[model samples]
Target chain A: MKKLHYSELWCSSPRYWGGLAALTFIILLGMAAAYYMEHSGHWVTGMSNQVVWGLPHVFAIFLIVAASGALNVASIGSVFGGPLYKPLGRFSGLLAIGLLAGGLVVLLLDLGRPERLIVAITHYNFKSIFAWNIILYTGFFTIVGIYLWAMIDRKAQKFYQVTGFAAFFWRLALTTGTGSIFGFLVAREAYDAAIMAPMFIIMSFSYGLAFFIITLMSAYWWASRELGSHRLEKLKNLLGVFVGAVLYFSLVYHLTNLYITQHHGIERFILLDGGVYTVMFWLGQITIGGIIPLFMLYSPAFSDNRFAIAIASVMVLIGGFVQIYVIVIGGQAFPMNLFPGKEVVSSSFFDGVVAAYTPSLAEGVLGLAGIAIAMTLVAVGARMLKVLPESLEDPEQGTA
Target chain B: MSGNREQPKEIKRREFIGMTVLAAGAASVAPGILLTVAHATAEAEGASSEVRWGLLIDSNKCAESCNACVDACNRENGIDLLQRPQGQGDEMWDAQRPQWIRKVKLKDNQTGEVTNLPMMCQHCEFPPCVDVCPTAASFKRADGIVLVDRHTCIGCRYCMMACPYKARSFIHQNVEQQTLRSPRGKGCVESCNLCVHRIDAGATTTACQDACDKDGHQAILFGDLRDPESALSKALREKSSRQIRADLELNTGVRYTSL
Candidate 1:
């Protein structure tokens, strides 16, 4: 095998400057949006007592889940001994940290009392899965940071495998903690299933890989790097498998819910009657996010086409967002079964009726800003550090 | 003879002055002694684990049109004073405002028999809100009243999501005006605290129960569940009461009869 060489992203290019400027603009806008929401209170937003978590949560959760998945590439290289993936570890580590930072920023800013974050850190209720998640998330950064150091530092190279193993397990725990945030909620019918944890893990795999692919492609394309078709093919194929796994989990989740008589109402709401949620499930998640991407990745006609592969990855991301939206927002929309055998005829509270939510401009801006922040971090890291491999070109015959 | 008269007058005057001073001292000390005794009595009545506070409601006695309990709770908790922020839509404001208690009318699916009752935080022995709170801000008092510590509440809303009865409400807007008893603010999760201030003050009843009695329905009865001779315990023994969502086995402090 050829010896690997790494280089920093060229910062002198006009395109680089332009991209940085755009990301900075978006980040500024997001900050403003956050400030507006914080100052005016949540009443200014579409979120109400019924739909307490809105668009910001969807974005925050997506980024957090995806952050763990982004590290999968590094884990595969260092832990599993995938030779081709080894060289990509540095960038993968950078991307993972970037995604997590972006996600955490959004989550913190969206809190009702964001100023009192110190209380959250100091006070912990051991029984709460949320409290556990705070530890998991912070631990992820520490572990991944060490893993990245192991990859980059020549002196620390010997510890790569050990750090990789730790980071791998830590990422799994992080994703599990994220999933349990929903799974442990016994009050909601849509959540509270053991399957939620595994499903979220699968979702992270798909979303993280999709994000990694798009970022890799965009960065290489911009920097005039020789990214070989073989590497692209391998990554896209893996993405397809993750997508298929997600679809399988989705099927099992719904099927299991359907079998239980108690869950029939929630199942029916998501599958058949829930207007926006049902449409998002079938049209956005299953078709656009799942089936089409699988087709693009597996089919002979589209698999080789880089543009098609990119589109497929984008679709997977869109589907992932829709899936989370359905889970978070749609789950809350279904009114709780206060009276199992009784129909709520009237109440001052919006009982027995679906809660309504419309994403406000500020919410949308804030969500997009998280993505911009993640991209900015990756961009800046690449520019400053020798994270990216010099080239991913296929070796000539007999070169090894 | 003049000196002797003067000396007698001085002694009489001195005696009168001393008697008046003693009277004033006793009068001042008496109220202080009485107040200390009252304070001690109040302290003795402080929330105790032995006395489990709970509410027992008779659905049959709840009048459908009378919203006295909910209205009274709003007044008592200062929930009625929350004003809609300027530019907030009426519908949105209605959904965002904090509601400690609300009247709910349920129709039995099989029998078509309608039942009217008030719904609020049940103050479960094992409250899911308390269990899910990351900061332990949502906690059950020693006497079984579940409350959110506003200072520590990060306003994650996880507690609201965990609650089964839709009992909790998030304060979405800045609360400029709040009752001294409630002390609510924006960005914190709140629910029915079962009129804990009244309970702490040694009041035997809640605002909801008081209003229900004034309305002559007398649907709500507040008392110590531990007290066997209390009116709530006696009524519970006479009537078969069931907790909402008893299947969850939460062992709720609030129980409803004729539902």
Candidate 2:
């Protein structure tokens, strides 16, 4: 087998490398900000008491789901035996495993006491959604490890069939557990509904597809030189469906919250109020993450172009973060008890009652660090593992 | 320690068997939040089997004239003034703060409908805070009382998040300023310990309970939820008491009978 090689194209390709560099730079700034926050204190950032766990947590959770999801190769190969996808199989497992590792790093960095994360692991809190997530991440990582090793370690294919399925289902269960952490909060009224868990799974699928498609497309652009239109189209179409799923699920989730509980004042306050977060939810998540990607990909002209597909993929990443931010942060901003007194009027959403929380600069940077760390890992993995095929047999133009 | 992690060793058969046992043990524990910390605590060997502490609040008699419980609790626990008022950046946790408990008046009907509800931790039997606490820092004693262990609390504020009564508060700053009894200040969640310090000392009741214990006309009751023979439990049978937020299904330890 030919050892994988990095093309000069990777460095020269303004589109892919440029985006990668920009993402890296953004993440670097975030890292510096995070370090400062950790050294100084949470006060250095925008996070007030109202919105305690802000951007970093939201971004981390989004990254987590995305990381868990970016393992589509394991899902398709282990679940359905998609031999066409076999080349990408072990590599997908690597991405899934890598992204999760990165996500955990960002989350820990965001904590006021990173030292306690291990304490958290050793101590265990079956009741806290956050504690269970620690276990969930650990378990999910294990399954991916076994599955990836079985795929790549040569003497392992025979064992991997069992291992791959384990990894696939465990990742599914892990993501659901992650979702349930938010969903089971009967106290957090916004997060209590059944919709969130399934929404997470669907998001995993969409984000997983987006990540791989962009990565594979970048690799294909150089080594294969094939511009494999039909295959690329098929991949785009599949991604398009997940994007559609994201759109549909988001619409249903928000509308259901709005429609069923329209009279429920606090819920309505979140969905409609001039709260910046509410706007972000409606605009950034519902519009940018869901609709724009769908519009771009669902259209034939846009879907066919590799550049367009890549852009749509980027949108998926952004939109996913926005959506999670809305849930994790917005859920906290509302006072759970809803005590009415002479101080604040009944049925009024903004009677100096709204909890205020904003992610400090450190929180934002640390969040960025998560993304940077992911991209760096992917880049290194691509370079070292030779996961991307350095050669393609034939080529066809997109115009064909 | 910070870089790429080596591949985890594959689970050996022995480890698998061990994990299975652990999983089984974990499964036996209730699916709610308390399982996380059950091991950390020993079953308190208090004289159990007959102490049902209950509270009877005469809503008809509640006049917000005196907030003695807040004062007594503040003095007892060394809670700060929380001077910024509710919804501000003041870091201390106390009973009178917006995030914790407070007394308030509500009027309806335009003409009349005035009443006072001295609200605080209801200390539910099936505490949602206890159920959802990931670290299991928010613990319910074997005697049906809830207590927060300040040291173990990770400050995820999930208890604050899970609490239906809005009873818990997150210490925003390092709470070095504490009274001699339980000096917890920053980054941990605190609520009405229901005066646990007083209870453990074999006192008749908590400070608030004692303060409400006005001239034999009782306002707050403190006894074991497990005890059926206690006067508080006896009054529970006689008076139609209501919980602060029963809809949460926490099965609160403290019952309130509106007078």
Candidate 3:
């Protein structure tokens, strides 16, 4: 091993400016969509009284969960003493912060009254998990910020392990808080299970690592830097394990629901009868998001192909988003069981029937904006700070 | 000296007559004064914890065709005045519109018996809406009436998700006109407050209860559950009544019989 050198991203290229401008345009479009929704009301969106949370939540929750997982590389370096991961720690922290900011912005702008954000900040019910999450999200920023500082500043290196440990636990708690948001909903049949917390944690691991790998490869490629095959192989392998864990949790979640007679109807709906939900669960989530990525990463035929790895990572993100959609939207789409044995023949409130939701164009733009915001942040951070290593070439190749 | 003594005697006689007249006047007005003061005190105190306002609904008596309670609730809350925004579809508008109360028809799976009832907020003692509200905007009054403070509600709709009864409605469009009693607006979650304005105005009856009585059904009974001597309490004592989803043990302020 040789001494590592880090530098700011080279910004003189036309590609850098083009990417920034594109991200800016998307962000502006998102803002306009948000303004339209706010000006008209929630009626503009496909969300109704039945499906209170919609597509925006799907994107928002994905980013937030992935944000915690983005810090894994840094944790592996400082907390677990992995020297190979050390050079990646600074960029990990930067990505984590960027992702969180993007998620929070989408969440804020989608509010029925975004201006009353101060009310949400100042007033809190301690009993509510939502209030607890607000605190957890804020604390994550502070702790991760300190961890990034420790890794960057030479004088602060002594506190690296302490900050790393704090960041690690805080991210775990943050993901738990996000999962518990649904788990604690006693009224909704799809979300009452206690398994939601651990499931979300595993989900974060897969989604975050997948995102990290894609971004890392893109950055290195753009910089014309040599990223060794060994590092890529290591990341893809870790991603496979995380994806497998997510699948295991999904199996347990569905199996547990299947065993309980009470959850039979909802299980049947998601697995068989639910039109869009079933397709998304099997095709988008399980097959595309889970199985395909695993095959691409582990298959010997595609071992040397960088394109296959990138595609697998992209697929993982797509699958993760669909998984969230099934959870957030599909869960709400199922009618609540107000009467156990009695069937609802008539009701003004759309009871005993599946609620319909179709994501509007405004919602789509707003969700895309969150991704653009995150990418923009990472790009800006890389350009301004020495967060990226000069090269990840093998020490045996004399380019370390 | 004699003239002075005579003046004093006259004064004493005069004082005695005045005292008797004053005593008579005080006796005549004292009851009225006491009643006025008591009425004022009740109004000043607002909703009291000692009095748990509740509703006793007789589902057996509720007519399948009659929507008196729903109509009354809408009219009273100014929900009827809300107009759908331009270019909005009827199906979407129906889903988005606010409904404080609505009729629900249920048939027994095994017995094949039909039942008609009006569904609204159960006003639970341990309201899940209040529990899940991050801003504490969804709160229960001391008198057991659950309410949403529009001023503080960020319209996050967590309360809507938390509500088991499907009783809450989010205001989706701009409310151009609303009754002063309800003061509703866009971007807020609201539900049946059980006509809190009427309760505070010293009215013992709710709009639904009044409408039910007028329609010759008398299916709804509004009273103070704490007052055992009240009609609602006596009815509960004589006939068996159960709260909806009693297994949750929320001890809902609303109860139904002959379901």
Candidate 4:
């Protein structure tokens, strides 16, 4: 490609200010919810000893995972030298940073003592994966920040490959760390699988690409700029492959569990009798998140249609939330079988019963706030910086 | 100018010999001030390595419907009186309450035999809670008591998720006027510490064990597992006691008899 010209997205438009206002309002509301939950204690929320992590975690985790995946476009461009993806690289890096910042905000706010986050930073517990993740998350920001800078600065352009590669590997570690947060949980039958790590990586890839494609299409549309069908095709095809990979992992994970006699009860709970979770698995995660997206991306009828692709991206996002919900809350709902053969008839705590959790309105606001915060960052940053490309219209001038 | 006055001192041989003697004298007394060594079967002013504090519960002696231990534990830990929103339903408050110990009535399908046990933190030698704690707040004492250090606990509750026994409870509400020994608070995960405060204060057993004995059940026995002559150890040797979920190989400090 010839030298691509970048410009700041105009900030004066009513559409821009309106979007910013809406996002800020939601963010403030979320902050208030967090304060209430913190001050009044977690009892106000539906979260109990059983379902320790609630709705906010679902959104925070999804965003964090999606953040790592968002950088894949830049990785393909800079790390693998994908000519078609090079123009999208700057926007991809910015999105990754924005998404991470948003996710971290929700997570920190949800902490038992949000003020004592300094302890999490200063204390070293190498044995815990959570401690390792803190390093990975902070390191990701520094590495990706440098990677973004390298892409933008003419003097630092030569070092793009090094920084880009570092960011790529860092993101992989970040997602893997995120997955292992559940996977390392040996006590929970639902989370003790090794596949969670790779599954999350693939999940990140699909969710990230879906997010990127949607944002790319809409941002260009809002600017009244042309985004070629060729660029869309590249992203669409890659998204299908990722979605398929996730399905394969999900299949193997269940199959592996089915093979083990010890795991039969958990499998039965998740696949068959686990009412809400079962429906979520089949309808939300598999059918909506997985199958529909695959059909949209690969089907000849919908392949060329931008609207279909957009719908599929949104479906994948919806599915991503349900999938995380199943993994986190569903896993907790299944009671721990402290006594293998003997059935626990009664207990002071709700033992041997599927724990109940209904996400409170406060939690809902907090979760949506995370998404709004991410969008706001993207909106403000795009307006102030030379992030978005001028156009992807001229094929003759394009690297592809 | 500041360095010139301090840097010029050179010690003579006699003065150096005198200084060395004084240093040796300080070193000799330092161990007494800073160090406390282990003594067998005796309280040597700190938790001892020679004693592995453990609990032995006789399921046969425990009544199937009894909750004395649970109630005692609740009273001792200030868990029973934890503040909640007024007018909250009993079921809602029960679910929200922090339970350090609970009466579990288990029925064996194969033999049609029923077992009654009070379940709490097993205080494992290699506790998964301790392993997964991000801040090392969920820690095991030198004497094998697993307790949450409230000061350091971040309330992430990853330890609660990691616990196989479901022994840990997260305080989901703001607390006030907690028991003198256990300072209760919201967001932090807590579990039975075998009444470490009582043990440290020279009490021979935990609150639950004392409650059970007072109730005339004599099901719960607390003693040193490391000492072969200890009642807990003797009971283990004489009776077939098993750890719940022994397949995990946690080597728990809490053992059950006649299960």
lDDT of each: 0.92, 0.67, 0.92, 0.88
Q: Which stretches of candidate 4 lie over 4 Å from their true place?
A: A397-399, B1-44
Worst 10 residues of 2 chain A by lDDT: A342-351
Order of quality (DockQ): 1, 3, 4, 2
Model 4 reproduces a share of the real contacts of: 0.77
Comparing candidate 2 with candidate 4, which one achieves the higher lDDT?
4
As a whole number from 0 to 100, the lDDT of residue A180 in candidate 3 is 97
TM-score of chain A of 1: 0.98
Per-candidate interface DockQ score: 0.66, 0.14, 0.60, 0.53
Q: Candidate 3: misplaced stretches above 4 Å?
A: A397-400, B1-43
Residue B90, candidate 4: C-alpha displacement in angstroms: 2.8
Candidate 1, residues A1-400, lDDT tens digits: the string is 6678888888457899899999999999999999999898899899988998999999999999999999999999988988778888999999999999999999988999999999999999999999999999899989888888888889998888899999999999999999999998887899979999989999999999999999999999889898988888989999999999999999999999999999999999999999999999999999999999999999999857999999999999999999999999999999988898999999888899899999899998999999999999999999888899889997665552
- How do the residues B1-259 of candidate 1 rate in per-residue lDDT, one tens digit apiece? 9999899899999999999999999999999999989877887766789989999999999999999998999999999988889988877877888888888999999999999999999999999999889999999989999999999999889998899898889988888899989989789999999898888877999999999999899999999999999999999999999999898789999999999
Which scores higher on TM-score, 2 or 3? 3
True contacts kept of 3: 0.82
lDDT of 1 at B162: 91
Chain B alone, TM-score of each model? 0.84, 0.70, 0.83, 0.81
Worst 10 residues of 3 chain A by lDDT: A391-400
The prediction achieving the highest DockQ against the true structure is 1
> What TM-scores do the predictions have?
0.94, 0.80, 0.93, 0.92
List, residue by residue over A209-305, the lDDT tens digit for candidate 4. Answer: 8889888887887788778888889898999999899889899999999999888988999899999999999999999999989998899999789
Listed per model in order, the count of residue pairs whose N, CA or C atoms clash below 3 Å is: 0, 37, 0, 1
